[model samples]
Target: MLFVKTVTSFMAVQCVRSRVCHRKFWGWLNAVFNKVDYDRIKDVGPDRAASEWLLRCGASVRYKGFDKWQKDYNHLPTGPLEKFKIERIDATESCIMFKGFDYLDYLEHVEEIKFQRCIYIQDECLERLCRIQNLQKSLQWLEIISCGNVTDRGIISLHLLKNLRYLFLSDLPGIEEKEKTLQILIRALPNCEIKVDL
Candidate 1:
């Protein structure tokens, strides 16, 4: 009877240790995964093992300038990435190349998007963003700084975001007539605070 109790206690202690180890492993993985950007994605993109690791722990991953290096790599394994619970995406100082918006479709939980300094963001990218049903409903804040490629046509697509509250478009050279565009946006979204630096 004593041996039985001792064995049970030992098993309980092992279980506790295993839980602690699992937590520690996940914590470490999260820390490493959060640092993944376009530069590191190159190395992780080709390696199946690294991609798998990212897929498992990349729910909180924030890829700034993802479009800068995205063109260099072939399509990474996205099967497991579909399950990632990405909430915020920042692609500042990058390019939103052809069909680049398609990659964000899987992120159903995305709320905030920052494309500040993205020189390649154009009408096509905005069109793609408009098509995202989840983003249309859930997205609240959007920042597009110094994106000269985005014209009035591109800005028109953003009117579909019924829930958007904050819109920032600073130093956009394409917007030749800023006041007219600002007026149009204000009339369309009376509740939203739109900021533009022409």
Candidate 2:
């Protein structure tokens, strides 16, 4: 019985060590993914560079004239350097943390953005996004679904996007007092169509 207990304890310790190692590895990888490549941006322009960053982080971007969403980081569409402008982004289940959001700053044609099951998007990310002047004028549609870190503060900050015509919120358990949030948003953005799901 002593030998059995010792072996079991050793096994548990090994398991814990392995899990910690695994977590550390993914954290390192995410950090790497978030690193901004300013040289790449200077060479390729904001739209193309942002596309690469989005795709690398498991997000998809649709170019202005494209019907299909570009998903593969390895097989991004090739064209003239800045010809393919990102018009919409779908960051569902993506690892797009705030550190990588600088890529989106200079994009001028982005009309829509979707954040679904994105684990790294917090209230600060929304605040930064809403403050971008380019997005403030150009973005017209926004969706946030199943992103647990987003709360009423994040939702409220989106009032800066006055051009947004449609906003969808669903499965966001972090948002308390959805009705009050909705009323505030409605008053702030009179023409916008807002939907909230509890």
Q: What is the TM-score of each candidate against the true structure?
A: 0.58, 0.96
Give the clash count for model 2: 0
User: CA lDDT, every prediction?
Assistant: 0.62, 0.92
Model 2 lDDT tens row, 1-198: 999999999999999999999999988898799889999999999998999999999999999988999999999988796679999999999999999989988999999999999999999899999999999999999999999999999989998999999999999988998888888899999889998786
Backbone clash total, candidate 1: 0
* Tens digits of lDDT, candidate 1, 92-147: 65434433344454345656777777655787888788788878877888888777
Q: Local error of candidate 2 at 12, Å?
A: 1.6
Model 2 lDDT at residue 36 = 94
For candidate 1, the 10 contiguous residues with the lowest summed lDDT are 64-73
Worst 10 residues of 2 by lDDT: 74-83
Model 1's TM-score against the true structure: 0.58
Residue 19 shift from truth in candidate 2, angstroms: 1.5
